[model samples]
Target: MDADAAPRRVRADAERSTARILEAAEAVLAEDPTAPLERIADAAGLARATVHRRFSSRAALLDALAAQLAQRYVQGLAEARVDTAPPVDAMLRMTETAFALKLAHRFAVQLTASMTPEVQGGLDRLFARLREAGAITAPDPTWGRRVYLALLHEVNDLPADSPMLDGDDLAARAGLLVGTVLRALGGVWPPAR
Candidate 1:
């Protein structure tokens, strides 16, 4: 049992390090896209060698960042429960959740502007449902998606350390973005605040 436990512990440690590296990469790269491996290692509180061992090169690190962003985007959508709620309610919730996520992962999303087909398909399905329910009248899912992303991305550019970034202010920002995008998408006027 001890022998089996040794390998499990090693695996757990590796996973933890990998997660740390990915997170550190996101923060560092967001600030300096050309930041060196040493910066990321310092941020992760690990040696540069450890990061090299986990990720062979800068490209590899960026690749991992893209994958993480894709996963996080899907998870954010799922957590918003857009499919289960009314169109306006779901849109607001999803907008708020997505804004929060994008704000947190600014660099990751920038690196992965075009998501995998699987992620895009999921978004398509959600928008289709909204259209069928008459919540939105956008003729093209891609257009609606582009408009929504543009709005969300702009919100992420807001001053991070601003005192106005409290819950109410964030919610208001999300509401504003949602209202603007929905209107642009031919969605009904006056989304629930």
Candidate 2:
């Protein structure tokens, strides 16, 4: 093997290990926010010393996890294609995507409440479109935005006594949350059935 190739391989391995640690951290923390670093290391198949070497401390780990979640949230917004979808559809899509991630990484999402400007702008555009399409009827734009944020928070704020939802249960709850928000905005619910 070439000498340069050896360093490249080591770096690649390190990146993989770091990704594993972050993924494990999210999963373990999802189940228990106060899980120990040793447990996180074990979940990642790494030694506790290795986890410490990588993160230094629990606070640093949380910081890294928060940053990771924020970045993932931004990426999920892009993937949801809010810019092109009709405003109402986009809102539902984005809400579902956000709720899924927020559910999977509840602690990390709690730690970081800031959104990137691009996401904020996209959301603003969606709100305007919703108003224009007569899907929402708030007198002030800010009120509409506030209502949307509140609904999003409500959906993400799962009850402490709630058990982990399966795929079907999660989809049902997300649909209910979306439907409720739409109803609040004067959109019809139950589709006139």
Candidate 3:
């Protein structure tokens, strides 16, 4: 074997283990915010000592989860093409992306309670674009962003099997959310504002 192969394999193993722990933590914490680290370990199928070795404390693990959530949000926004898409189209895309991320990371969404600076900056730019395009007519456009985020939170709290969140229902949900936000911001309903 190459001299570097052993270390590379070990690093890959560590990364996988850490990812498993974070996924398990999100699931366990979403079900019960006060679940213990041992419970998280059980969910991850990892030994308590392994979890402890990976994250020195619960706070550290939570911090890692929050970081992962922020990274995913950034990536989702990019994939949604928020910067280049038409304002209204971008809003719909962003809503769909946020909805999925919020559902996947319920505990992190609740824990953060606010957008990370990067996410906030991206949304602020998008809202500005919306206003420039007349898709938002609110004199104070900040309310638009707030309302958009509030709608995502509401949707995120829905039961996993809700009809609104069924596999093919995502587009309809996104359209409803974007349309409501536009109207709430004084834009016309049929997206012609």
Give me the candidate number with maximum lDDT: 3
Q: Write the per-residue lDDT of candidate 1 for residues 86-164, one digit (tens) a residue.
A: 7666677777777676678778877754377766765666777777777689877777777777777776666755543
lDDT per residue as tens, model 3, 1-193: 8999999999999999999999999999999999999999999999999999999999999889988988888887888787899988888888888778777887898767236888887887788888988887886556677788888767656665677654446676787678778888878767753
Give the TM-score comparing model 1 with the true structure, all chains together.
0.86
TM-score preference between candidates 2 and 3, better one: 3
* Model 3 stretches astray by more than 4 angstroms: 139-141, 158-168
Candidate 1 local Cα displacement, residue 109, angstroms: 1.9
Decide which is better by lDDT, 2 or 3: 3
The stretch of ten residues in a row with the least summed lDDT in candidate 3 is 160-169
Sorted on lDDT, best first, the list reads 3, 1, 2
What TM-score would every model get versus the actual structure?
A: 0.86, 0.75, 0.89
User: What TM-score does prediction 3 earn?
Assistant: 0.89
- Model 2 Cα lDDT, one tens digit per residue, 18-136: 88899999889888998999999999999998888889899988888877877776786677666677666677777778778776776677674445555566667777777777776
